[model samples]
Target: MYTLKKSLGQHFLTDESICRRIVASLEAYPSRQLLEVGPGGGALTKYLLELRDIDFKAVEVDDDKVQYLKKTYPAIESRLIHQSFLDMAPPFEGPFTVVGNFPYNISTEIVFRIIEWRAQVQSTVGMFQKEVAQRLAATHGNKVYGVTSVLTQTYFDVEYLFDVPQGAFNPPPKVMSGVLRMTPRAAPLDVASERKLFVLVKTAFNQRRKTLRNAVKSLFSEEELQDDLFNRRAEQLSVAEFATLTFRMR
Candidate 1:
């Protein structure tokens, strides 16, 4: 009944099989708490509501979709959080799994929020613009590889699950969508400092075409830049290699 608003990136999923497949992937990990982001049209929310074992909640930004979900699925009356996933405080007291057909407009921001909550979020299964998904699952040497690949891979093991065609939604997106699953690493990466690593990664990629020595020259000294790792470009360094560069920073 609600009109799809292009500004909000509201392309509601009408496909049943893909919805179930995504929910199944969310349940693949054992979670006592689960949260769904942007449950537009209740495509995935209905199935998640049926699960009896976990505490399930969904964050929805649109008022119409929120009212519709509460009216259609009375089971979610208390489970729904009427706020943007970006603005909401942590929904659960402890660890939880996050799933959804996330808004393409803010999909990348959603990933950054998950990273911010990396300690409490056990895993995540969400759909993203295919190019973004490729970058998330990408490794060094891949053209799409950049900030997301390194930042996300720092805390979670990225997995590209599958791709969904444009036809899968009511107002299908112009670009194809891909789904990915991210599980937290059992141990945090052994970086000298997480903040330093973040700066290092972002700075190096700010001038991606330049060699690391030139790209991140401001962050290091001439003596420190003598390492061979500085000879490579930003896209050529792996996650571990980036951490090592962080420790070497002056």
Candidate 2:
């Protein structure tokens, strides 16, 4: 067994039931190709490999964990990638689904990376710190709703599937964990450009308590800020509103 590295945020999922639930969530969106991020100790990898008709791959940054997984499960030797999921390229040739119990430290970064590859990532089911998971699936008017909520919901339909408790892991985390699934939106919100929308959403949330006019003054003209929408705080605008506002940006 490999040691859990705190610096890498390695809290391996030890609960078989939660593992099956995560896998079941991914299976909801059928894809020929599937990628698992940070398969620390092959908890989910074992079940994923058992699925028929899937071209499966797992990206693991931890060298020791990779070796442990290979020695423990010989079937994944060829499919396991020894690289950070953030720095790696798309593992499959076409559309694929992603599943993982993400490292808590870089969980948000992983979500953004997946968003960058949204066109080819058909769907995703991942476990995250409960608060972060709520942020991903949050809608306008929810206090947790912010940049991640708006940006992610712009292209995918986010679902808060279920929650997992701290005791489920070998080294139980201090906080609760939750699982979420994301599937491509049949009709993604219209925006001037994804770049502009990202800029607007991130900037607007930089001072989330402030109204849009004060928070995003840099991106829009003084006159444009006079609109009624500018009176609302960042968390009050829906994903579609954020996308539409991008077109009016300077």
Candidate 3:
């Protein structure tokens, strides 16, 4: 048995039913190559191994958990990659699906990583802190909508699958967990420069309480800032609107 490390955000999912449902969600978006990030206690790993049609692999940063998982799920022994997901390349040369009960502390970074690999990751299903899940699934005008929502929705069709209770884990997290299913859009939203869009989105949200005119003044000319659209706050702009703004920025 491996001890949970607080630094790693390891709350091992212990509920059998929740485990089945997560794997079922992954099956809904079938893929030949799949990667499970942070297979903490192997709750979901148990079922993922049974998917004979897929080439499944698990990535674990913790050496103890990696050893534990390999011992517990001998079937995944050869396929397990001992690594922090933030550090690895796409598991396959071609397209793949990703799934996991992701570490909460680094969950935001994980989303960014997935976006960086958007061309290769066709779909993803995973558990995240409920608040983060909502942000990822939210559209403009939703209170929780912010940078993550804009960036993720720019590239994927985000679905808020379902919520999981704290009691579902061995050492429950303080907050409720929500599962999300993200599938790549047929065509990602257009942007003049991906870099500019990212910078603009982050800048706007950093001053979210201010109107875009006031918040993003530094990015635009006085005339551009004078546009009627700048009267709205960052949260008021849809992802497409943000993309349009990106092109207008200096």
Candidate 4:
């Protein structure tokens, strides 16, 4: 029997139905070139391969899993990379979609990396800790709303598709998990300098207890602080509002 490795955050999806549903969520996109992160035991990978038109590229950090995947699916050998997803660049070329049962520890980093390559990726369907998925799909004024909510919302139209119960995985995570499908927006609602917005959001949520005005004090001049929008806590502001604040601060 396969064992879940705690160090690698390995929680294999024992439910094939959930795997199929996650893949189905990306049915709108051309799945020819698909990038999967952490394909533990190839549960999801197997279903993705069954899609006739699809070509799969997977980035798996664990050496054992990497070897197993290559040996088990020789057809996808060249497509697999035994490296951390963060180390690889995106736009795996061709018409591509990204799907994975992502490791919870590095989920935020992975999302940000994907956001960096949002221009090339058609869409992304991945699993995340339920709370993180909620935050990514949260609207303004939600208690779980924070930097990730604003930054990701700025680039993608996020949908919290469904919850995967704890029992669905080999070694169940303590909390429930959810799948998120993020399609890039046609045009960002209120475009600000991305770098500035990133910094602004990071600062604002770095200390959630502080009001936006205070949190971003170092980044903005006193004159920039005159706006009423930057006066509230980070959770209280909308993504567009944050974009506007970032633009003004720049």
Candidate 5:
């Protein structure tokens, strides 16, 4: 049996039903140029390969798992990459789907990386800690809303699909798991202004307790943010409101 690796934040998915659900989220795609991040023990990988016309590439950080995957699925030996997902260059052209049962610790970073490569990725379906899932799908007015929510929402239409009980994994995580589906926006609210908006969102959430007037004070003149909308905390503003603030700053 494959053992969970603490250093790698490994928790292999043993539940086949959950695996199918994760894969089903990617059903909208025409080509199956699927990129599976951290395919621990190949549970999801196996299912993905069974699809007609499907081709898969997996990025795995664990050396042992990489070797095992290569040995177990010789057909995909050339496609399994042993490098860290953060370091590996994205293969394939534009608009591929990425799916996985991600490592809990690095899940956020993985999503961020995928966002960076949004030009190549059409959509994403993955499992995350329930708390993180909530944050990804959070709206501007939700208490759980913050930098991640704002940044991700700026680029993708996110959905909190379903919850997986702790018992689903081989070594069940203490927290519940949630599946999230993310599709890139047709056009960003302000595509060229993303950097400024990112900075503004980060600053606002960094001091979430403070009103936007105070949190974003450094980025704008007092006169610019004197509007009534700036009087509320970061959590109180919607994604469009945040975009408005970003445009004003620019």
Candidate 6:
């Protein structure tokens, strides 16, 4: 038996219903290659392996959990990658769908890494802190709508699928968890470059309360900043609006 590691944010999902729901969400996006990030206790991993004709891999950071998973499900021994999902290379060369009940501590950073691999990540379905999930699926004018919302939506369509209560886990998390399904956009947003869009959005939201002119003044010239759009706060702009504004950045 593996002891849960608080340092790893290990709140293993104990609810079979929640586990099936997550797997169902992943099945909605068809991909032969699948990568499960932080498959803590094989709650989802067992179900994922049952799918036919799919090449599956799971990344687990904890050696104890990895050993436990291998002992419990010998089939996963060869499939599991014993490393941090953050530092691992793409599990598949071509497109793949990612799934997991992400560790709360590094959940947002995981999303960022997924965005970095956007080109090959066909879709993703994972659980996150409800607030973080809302922010990813949030739209302009909502208080939770900010950099994550803008940057992620720039490449994928984020869907807030369902909520999982805190009690669904063995050692229940203090906060509620929600599942999100992200599918790549049919076409990428027209931006100067992903880098510029990232720079512009991160800069604008760094001072979210300030008007774009005040918040991102360093990215654009005083002349360009005079546009009426600059008068609005960062949260007022849609992902497309942010992508468009990237063209005007210095």
Q: State which candidate has the highest TM-score.
A: 3
As a whole number from 0 to 100, the lDDT of residue 63 in candidate 2 is: 87
Residue-wise lDDT of candidate 1 within 1-250, one digit each (tens)?
7768898988888889999899889757979899999998899998998888889999998999989888889999999999989998999999999999999999999999999998799999999989999999999999889998998998899999999999999888899999999999766677878789889999999999999989999999999989888899999988888877777787
Clashes of each: 0, 0, 0, 0, 0, 0
Q: Return the clash pairs for model 6, or none.
A: none
Q: Candidates' lDDT values, in order?
A: 0.90, 0.92, 0.92, 0.84, 0.85, 0.92
Q: Per-residue alpha-carbon lDDT of model 2 for 1-250, expressed as tens digits?
A: 7999999998989999999888887757889999999999889999998999999999999989999999999999999999999999998888999999999999999999999999899999999999999999998999889888988899899999999999999799999999999988888788999899989988999999899889999999999989999999998888988988989999
**TM-scores of all models?**
0.97, 0.96, 0.97, 0.91, 0.94, 0.97
TM-score of predicted structure 6? 0.97
- For model 2, the local distance difference test gives 0.92
Q: Candidate 6: which stretches are off by over 4 Å?
A: none
lDDT for model 5: 0.85
lDDT of 4 by residue, 100-138 (tens): 999999999989998888877789999999999999999
lDDT of 5 by residue, 1-250 (tens): 4556988888788888988888877886555588889998998998887777867788898878888887887866888888899888887776688899989999999989988898788889999999999999998778899899988888899999999998988788899999999998766666438788889988999999998888888888878877888899999988877887776783
Clash pairs (backbone) in predicted model 5? none
Cα lDDT tens digits, model 3, 17-94, are 999999989878789999999998899898888898889899999999988997888999989999999999888989
Backbone clashes (count) for model 3: 0
